[model samples]
Target chain A: MYWNADLECVPLEQRRELQLERLKSLVRRVYENVPHYQRVFREAGLRPDDILTLDDLAKLPFTTKDDLRRTYPFGLFATPLRNTVRVHASSGTTGKPTVVGYTRQDVDIWSEVMARTLTCAGVTQDDIIQIAYGYGLFTGGLGVHYGAEKLGATVIPVSVGNTKRQIMLMQDFGTTVLACTPSYALHLAEVLEESRVDRTRIRLRVGVFGAEPWTKQMGRELESKLNIVAIDIFGLSEIIGPGVASECLYNTGLHIFDDHFLPEVIDPVTGKQLPPGEEGELVITTLTKEAFPLIRYRTRDITKLYEEPCPCGRTHVRMSKILGRTDDMLIVRGVNVFPSQVESVLLEIGQTEPHYLLVVDRRGPLDQLEVWVEVSDKVFADEVRHLETLEKTIQRELESTLGIGVKVKLVEPKTIERSQGKAKRVVDKRDLYNRDK
Target chain B: MWVKQISVFLENKSGRLAAVTRLLADHGFNIRALSIADTSDFGILRLIVNDPAHANRVLKEAGFTVSETEVLAVEVPDRPGGLARVLDLLHQAGINIEYLYAFVSKAGENALVLMKVEDLQRAVDVLSAQGITIQGHDVVHQI
Candidate 1:
């Protein structure tokens, strides 16, 4: 069995040779095993032998989200269901959730990737890892859960919610490393301060957050609150889970596990591949996944790909933090708006709950957006006039941040629907077909 | 003396007024007089409509956050001094006007003024005793 090494740290010539060899084997496996790949290759009128190097990767058919959804359930799994040890799914906002499976070997490889990520972040056996992400079909909680266990760190699988208990566990257990979504981490920090808990006394040193696209401003806020180093972890359930790549302590781009997953940047509109340092959609192909292998799956996440060696000495390809999903982009009154843009503005206006909903609808020929924000009791006294003033302030801030006018409705705290699992932040009521009419 | 009064909660957005108008139209109701008491985010769209109960149900069914309120619709002369007389009466009675709007009556000689006051019953009693003709619920529906 050939084991993959961190070839990016090795000499440039050696890394290129290794990548070329892996690329050739990956193409052969897809052509020989996957029926979809075979049909695509036949339609393209190209033989598997034509793709013998990394340069030939362009010849392969690009997989997309539509393909994954059309397959549904498990039509794309390369191995039998019995061989699969784990399954994870994305929230089915548009349609049926995309299901992904992993065999025993695949799970081992996932843990190994996460272990490398944690090790790169300076986490060791002496660290106590607190996993705050939710468990179950969602991969974030358990992905970090097992990865910490594999690294011989004391794992606290305290899933999401119950911030009071999470804070208690952090203080009592002396959690040195935290893994969670960035929003929840900030919520925890808020709860900690409200409860008069000294943030430094908890002894948290490092945090790995993902599962939602967060900005650098948010990362800095989280770092300042918890007095810990915050790093971004990147992955998707279709490709793997939370441990596909992670940022080092340097807080640059996340390093990809190029040995098992091939990363590429492509123009979202034309599907043409872009060169390094250019912003585009991140595409990945599972090189060694046996259970639910994906070939050149187009992730709608927008980011840039970098091939330059990081200061941390990892030869793995690097990806910048994802800005937003192309599918989630909202066009309100002929202007584009991302939920993260709203989130950034909310963060700056301290003492506000992160829970918010974007209501999009068309009024006559013009599109309108209303942001329902949950008001914190400290800022407003729950009176109608006070809440209204807060709403105006939110509207002004959002207009300044997004450069588009939006009406802000101040809802009572917890009035917005809470997500038991993956949160649905956007509620678009615009009729796309009628808009043209 | 009573007038048909209807209250509706409206979030501040463009075309929201159109939505309210369409709902009332679909229910075969017509606005007699209307006033909007607003804060920044939302407004209470108070109205004296053709049918209060029917308008309220239609607004609710249309998913608009709405409520019903009893406002006073005082009849005044079509002249400019007519509104001033009613305002002077209310001010003397210590009644605070939250908001008010005028309606074009069919007779053209008399105008209907919809008034939302802090105290509904007290204002009605004060206006009725002052010889100001309070339009009945039937006259409101007839409009």
Candidate 2:
């Protein structure tokens, strides 16, 4: 279960020393090659030599997605294109995509880290991994693919889409490990139930889900639905891709691959570092990324960091599941309505599926929050009174939990749109009012 | 005698009831009697089909939440107060009728009524002691 135990279980003191050394070298590399970091360092009146210990990481200039956007294509690459082996770009739905390059060593490190990710979930060489993540530009598919291959597991490079066929191959190939987004895993579970193939025939035992913020409730839902141990993998294209951190079978939290990625939580507005267990925006500094090393990159993901060693014995720092993005927090009627909070309520109430969509609309002055919950077999009752009672209970639960009155709408099964990747949680129709204004 | 009644849960949408009937009809299962307990959002279609077990299995396999409940089917006297007489008997025995639906029979002169009661065994005892004919599966299946 322990992949590269020496590095993973390195003593705390030794690990910090290693991190300090790596951080210093990464700063020097970026300072020498990437002009953006050089200019930012000059602006901060700091030199690469100033990065002495790991604690000095906070003093380094922060890298934002805007910074990555400013340096579009190869501007941030420390190594020349000839020296880099692979390049991956994030989905630039908001604006131009942020690109990242990796040298051969970086890719090898990615594979090793990803191999640790697999091993965290109890995956081994005897396991057959079905990679359902999208392959090309999206690093999730290939990142896991290379890692699974490196782990000596039989890799079924079945990229996303064709859900029915995905289920068929999953059963036929006897897949022992499934890798995809949490939402996509739920979608696959739904399809598997609706399909003719027997679930007992399927050999999937562990799921490596990432690429979007999902709830612990969703993680439990995935476990029960797919009958697999769900492990959460955290990574971004700006860093290295799907191997930055992972949840072991212990599943207390994701253990950041301490040897490679240095994680810190900071107050979003103040940018001051928050102590362990304080929820804030997560900032990560790549310690060993060669082709694209980042100094204190703002990930925009909100979560607390736990430096305590995991019961699984990995010395890497652990992090809570990403609560909500600092930028993507949905505010309706002045209440922060995170889809994960709504998800926890739904799953805890039981009977309803872990699928729901939040619709925020402004009628005149007040915003209306309508939750569309998928009625599953358990939620459905032959008696109208029973179903009505369930609806009322959900409304009451949401109102009490969220501190905002919500209209609960019970929709038919399979009515809500499911994503093959990250799920669409909210539909902000209040944009109509904004548009007209 | 207890008769198996299958209730299917469905969303209150146009043609949903028709869809359930169509599924049953396609499967060659004849509905002996039926009743719709509806609200604005959903409806529970209670049915007395020719084959309760098969109907329940097929309906469930088709993604419908189906459950079977046992109810007593009684033979009512072919008179003006036929249904009323049966209700009066149950009421006199202090047994509460949960729900009652009419089941017409082509093979018999007396009308058949399916009634679910709170105390099922006691209701059967009270009806049988009053010399009323409690219809069984053999009789209900023929209908």
Candidate 3:
């Protein structure tokens, strides 16, 4: 089931050798070309020769989102602007976006890895892939686009939006594979149901969903509603884009193309490397990236890595689903509330839909967490007592798990806005209060 | 006799009551009697509609949390102490009333009292033996 059987199924010993060789070359490249890495190395009193073995990567300083931001556009490019063919920027809603450049060969590498991504998801040349990730500076659209085309699959460059039209095209074109964010996939499912489009008419069998952190409940919901195998693909604009890693049909974990991109987990506060299977911040070093070769770039995404062989027969190490962003964690009355935790609670209860919004507000000096979830029309039709009991059950479970009191509000279906991209889950109103003060 | 009453759960937010009433009105469901039990955070809206089944379906379809329960409708004199006399009979019969609401009839000098109790059959028998007129759905709807 592996796409690049030669590399994907490589033995662990050879994989380490390949990673070490690539790491040596990458360290030399970044130091010789990019001033940022050169300065970082000088500050740490380390040299590229110091990184002979993979364990010596600890000697290097960690690159962070702030570092990328400080470098700004094109400052971190290892190659001259003339050698770069394409550039993609991260969606930095808070501030300036992190920019990444790719040479022609780098673009080809992206396409190759993307081709591998498609193959791992069971997509073939016979499949028609409709890429719903946005085009332009966002790497998702073009990244998935070129990869599908590389795999010889028919590519529909229909970027995001126009929900009804998307469904119509799926029916008319008999699209076999769909590529978009998981939230957008769910949104498309909702639109499909609303349009009453016959599911049998469409030929979608596989969905490559990513771009935001989602829950298993969401995965099950998407699979049942859209009638497709929903697989997760993990990537970031800083490293390469959407082709860094993906989950196979086995649904074990996402196989990080370790040969191309080396993955590591580190404690967020201590900045010390944590053992595999322990939850920590993900730090990735690009072993094959040319134009933007990052050295131990801290991705800020929280996850764990497992080195065990996958059932899919891929020897590459697997990473767990991205639970939440380190910055996205909410401290409510001294209790840490990860949206994923709330999602898991809701999923376990099985009383409401998967959609929810966490509202954190400041009540006087104390913080209050309010969870707004969508219940089915049938549950809503129950007696007031029953509804009260449901609310209490949700509240009790949340309090027990999150270690803080949470007010559960059952809202009407579709009241929360559906995103065609990343689902917006948390709304912190305390910031506004602080601003006013 | 027992009459079916529809109760809806509503968050204590502005325009919710109006929205529910507008939805029921839009569906041509006539309300026979209504009462609201309120708290700081939420409200329970209880209604006696002309067609409880049809109203329940339409309200539920409109995405309102609604439920149905059996409550008794008794006719009392419109004058003062009319409800007191009925309560005195229930007290002597050891029947405890949960909640009750009254509606003044335009066709006569009689007020309709919708009563909810733990035991509907026992309340009906006690009221019937005491000669209290337990109004059926037909009589209540007409009023």
Best by DockQ: 2
Candidate with maximal TM-score: 1
Worst 10 residues of 2 chain A by lDDT: A428-437
Runs off by more than 4 Å, candidate 1: A1-8, A198-200, A329-437, B1-9, B12-143
lDDT of 1 by residue, A1-437 (tens): 10124443666677667767777776777778667778888999978789777777877888876777677888777777889888887643232567889999989888887887787778888999999887887788888877788888999998877889998999899999988877678778777878988666699999888876666776788889888899888887778887788888776688888877888998989888999988888889887788888778887877888887887777778888875566766645323466767876787776578888999865532357889877543554312454566677878988866655798876545557888986778987743311110
Q: Estimate each model's TM-score.
A: 0.64, 0.59, 0.60
lDDT of 1 at B5: 68
Worst 10 residues of 3 chain B by lDDT: B102-111
Q: Which runs of model 2 end up more than 4 angstroms from their true locations?
A: A329-437, B1-143
Better of 2 and 3 by TM-score: 3
Give a tens-digit lDDT track for model 2, residues B1-143: 68999988777778878889999999999999999887676677899999999998998888777778888898888789977877888899899987888885643778888888889899888888988888888779768
Q: iRMS of every model, one decimal?
A: 7.2, 2.3, 3.4
Candidate number that wins on lDDT, 1 or 2: 2
Better of 1 and 2 by DockQ: 2
Kindly give the number of clashing pairs for every candidate. 2, 0, 0
What tens-digit string does per-residue lDDT give for candidate 3 at A41-139? Answer: 999998989998999988899987678767788888999999999998753322245689999999998998999999989999999999988788778
| lDDT (10s digit) by residue, model 3, range B68-120 | 88889887877899889988888887888878987655326677898987788
Evaluated at residue A104, the lDDT of candidate 3 is 96
lDDT at B127, model 3: 78
